[model samples]
Target chain A: MNITVNWGLLAPILAIQLILMVTALTSLYKADATRGPKWMWVLIIVFGQILGPIIYFVVGRNDRS
Target chain B: MRQFGLFYRKEMLEMARSYKWIWVPMVFLLLGVMQPVTTYYMPEILKHAGNMPAGTIITMPTPTAGEVLAQTLNQFGTIGVLVLVLSMMGIVSGERQSGVTSLIFTKPVSFIAYMTAKWASMLTLTAAAFACGYAGACYYTIQLIGSLDVGTVIQAGLMYMLWFVFVISVLLLISAWLPNSAGVAFTTMAFIMLLSFGTSLLSRYLSWSPSRLSTIASEILTKVETLSSVGPVLWISLCSILICVMLAVYRMQSQESISAKA
Candidate 1:
């Protein structure tokens, strides 16, 4: 099967990366997360790249419990 | 151990009573039933539909039992992983937030034992669901197709269960350690998915990273590879589970260091 994608695909990739980066950096503002939550955020950011950080932003960034 | 059993039974009962446990496995059963039932009748069902485009006919390859199994695993496997992660997301975090841990901790039982029992219960449930769901699909396939190699069927079932168990342990570990179970579960699921996609960009050599358990699970269903040939894959899977469990225990103990503001 021949499959192809245009360079335009890179646009979404770059956009997602930026969104993730911003979310990760902003999470420190939420609450006192202890080292545990903070490390988890970093793990999510590095490993999750886009989705990890995005999910953290949506669900975990609060740290409010 | 008896205490563990008593607690396990109580925990199991509690989990069962909540009705949340029904979410994923039941959906998986539907996926299983849909496999053979859909493949057996999809053409006829489509043909019987009310609207038909003139001169346009829906044509598909006559799906075999293998194809049905493949389709079921691929589809159910993806959704199953998501559901398992999501449902388990709240188990640990909710307990911590609600002071459930304190209730359990005041007892004479070691924290490790309590965590282990809970982890064991979830792991057992995860394995049972994976087995039952796929077993249903396999049995249905045999009913439709007349015969399949029992050895192949059992091997595939075991492989699939192992794949899912590998994933559940990660969630278990994350949920165990993270202050927020739901948050960790969601993040862990996202992490696995992202890793699966990210590895694709790297090399096919790393394609069998434990995160690709879903892909490998489905593939093992349709292909031939002895457990021995798949040893490296299995080893990585085991290692991943072990590391996750260890980290979770470490994290749980570490949680003690967090000042109780609540």
Candidate 2:
């Protein structure tokens, strides 16, 4: 069970995921209105991994703003 | 031409404003990286599953670089297609609902120009994002798995992109026909899934279908001999895309007349 983890190979994947999450969260914060409640989106963005932000961007955010 | 340029610029600006410029490529990059990393880590993952009896040996063969790249394309075929479709589903329908289309049409803008402008911008964003993703996938696949022939990779990528172009054109056509964004997304996805499935099930008869582009793309990556037969599929795809754009323009024109009559 002692497989050595290579951070070099894993770092870029982690960074990209972080960037996606942060971008979605920032957009959600700045959005004037959303399809659903703000707190719910925050929870989804935090917990939803790769798909959470995509759903928020696609369906959650209201386009008027 | 001037109106087309103006609309293209505005669409690009809107893409940037909505953070699609950031997130879509990031999503692509993420999807691209996940394939190689997961493939490399599969053995370790199996070990960590913690269900095997002690000393139960598991042997997994390492996949070649071309195979890995082909798998990456498969990833894109599924989730990548869904993301692009969702991002673009509302492009026209949203505008129509919010009265933006009416505002633009009130000007001297031609329907063909408007539709082409939208098509061009969507294609641009898609190309940029896909290139970013595919580059990431290639870099990691070579670094971790093995080296691939650059020429084959590029050829495979272009073939895969034809599939994207066909899907985007379909999106534009559906968006023009439907006033509801949700309906547009649903119908477009259904159309894509049915076509892809049908094409594979009837490959002998449907070889010229644009859906065959994805299969040809993976074949090119795996070093299969497909080049001799790629012509008809390519030309048919290009023709289908042109027809989709024209039909969409005609549909929008008819909708405007209906509204005018009301």
Candidate 3:
């Protein structure tokens, strides 16, 4: 149980998740309209972990709007 | 050919504008990287689960690199497919709903060119994402698990890529035939799940099915698959993809005539 996990080995994974979230959040901010409320998507993108941003990108953003 | 290139470029631009270019591949990379890392840490992960008796030794066989890579493919088969399908579900239906298809139809656009362009763009994105993900998985597997044969990995990757091709083709056909994006997504997901399940349950009767591509890919990784054994499935997959594309093109052409008469 005392095994020390190397942060270096795990950094890239966390970094990728951060990149996804940042991109999703930026897109949400710029969009004038989304499928649902803007705040709801902001919440989802930030709290939805890896899948949060993906869901927002796939279904949340209303391109027609 | 010129018209196809134009439509293909437009589709790619739309994908880039929508940020599909960035996020889809990122998700794939995350999925690919997590698999090998988690497998390498399985013992530590299980040990930290708690409630084990004092001095209880967790004896686990280390999985070979090929096994780890195959497990990565399984991860792609489920979650990777979902992300890819959902991202693509609206390709045709969305354009139709937004009146864009009608607007374009008013011009001298051929439905064949348009449909083929859409299919080609989707296949491009899928191939890029899969390649990035698989390469990441290979690097991590070699570093964390062990070394894998390069030939085996490439062969397995090709087989698995063909499965994605088949799935995307089916999705394209459904999106063309359906009017609603949600419906397109639902039907495609259901059909895929059924095909995968039925293939496994009726493996004897459906050995040549495209659904067998995943199993064949895994077998290749494990060195249990031969070229002759994979030939039928590969041929069937390519043929089905061609059929789906032709059917979708026909659907679009018929719809064009109907709209023109109206």
Candidate 4:
């Protein structure tokens, strides 16, 4: 039984992943520092390399501290 | 518990004082009426527009009650809940931000009682606004596009209600951790979108996920999935709610709001 992976369709997946990760990390740094929890940052960085990270930056991160 | 009723009324008064209740329902009412009327007259509207160009064929399709309901749901369904959530996002966390948490905590109110009152009052307000809008839409839809099947209408109404609840629950959690409602609103939508996209990706492996709960009813209506086939989805929704509520309560306890708006 062969479970062949298609890197072609999966190529966009990598690009998508990269974008998600970068954004999440920036958001983690920038998100509401006073209120946002540590794990929330960690989870975004760890789980959402491109998507999660980007989301963290865009949605979760608040640098009002 | 004795103060819960009083607190509820007080909260209700705050809501009434704001007059947001009036505008929200009025906006939703307009949406409800316009959805069907627009859909009903769309072809005629398009036909008139086509006279300006190389004549495009305009086929007038009669608008059905189901379509009107769908249109109403599409235009303003998820949005109204988000508005309500954003408006009340500061309810719990705001006290902390304004340095009033300690003051409130020092009062006769326990965290559980106060939080419960806050949650309950907000939920009531949201329900009233949502029901008014949805009911108005449904009523006008019946008058305009004819009547929906009673069972179907009821089911759809319930499903729409749950959808709003789902949204509010998410925002409620975000609000607990975040000091401001705008952040909560953005975070809620962003979180939901991320969850949706990521869950869809992971659903290739995991048979059940929270995202499925969102799409299940609509899918069932469209014959894309069976009603009973969505049991796992319901279970997932239950689990998500349980986790979110627990986390939100914990966060509210720890959240030291410092008037820090980002």
Tens-digit per-residue lDDT, B1-262, candidate 2: 9989988999999999899999999999999988988898898899888778999989988989999999999999999999999999999999988999888777767888899999999999899889999999999999999899999999999999989999999999999998898999999999999999999888888989899999999998988876437889999999999999999999998898678667
Arranged by DockQ, best first: 2, 3, 1, 4
Question: Candidate 1: lDDT of A58?
Answer: 39
lDDT of each: 0.65, 0.92, 0.92, 0.60
Reported per model, the fraction of native interface contacts reproduced equals 0.00, 0.76, 0.68, 0.00
After superposing candidate 4 on the true structure, give the runs of residues whose Cα lies further than 4 Å from its correct spot: A1-65, B50-52, B60-63, B196-214, B219-228, B256-262
Q: What does the lDDT read for residue A62 in candidate 2?
A: 89
lDDT of 3 by residue, B8-110 (tens): 9999999998999999999999999999999988988888888889899989889888988989999999999999999988999999999999999989888
Task: List, residue by residue over B55-163, the lDDT tens digit for candidate 1.
Answer: 7688897876776787887766577777677656766787788877767666666556666777787787787667667777787778765466677667767777777
Candidate 1 — which pairs collide? B89-B182, B93-B181
What would the TM-score be for candidate 4 when compared with the true structure? 0.69
Distance from true position, residue B233, model 3, in Å?
0.8
What TM-scores do the predictions have?
0.71, 0.97, 0.97, 0.69
Leading candidate by DockQ: 2
State candidate 2's DockQ: 0.75
Chain B alone, TM-score, model 2: 0.97
The 10-residue segment with the lowest total lDDT in model 4 chain B? B253-262
Q: Candidate 2: give the clashing pairs.
A: none
Task: State the DockQ of every prediction.
Answer: 0.02, 0.75, 0.72, 0.02
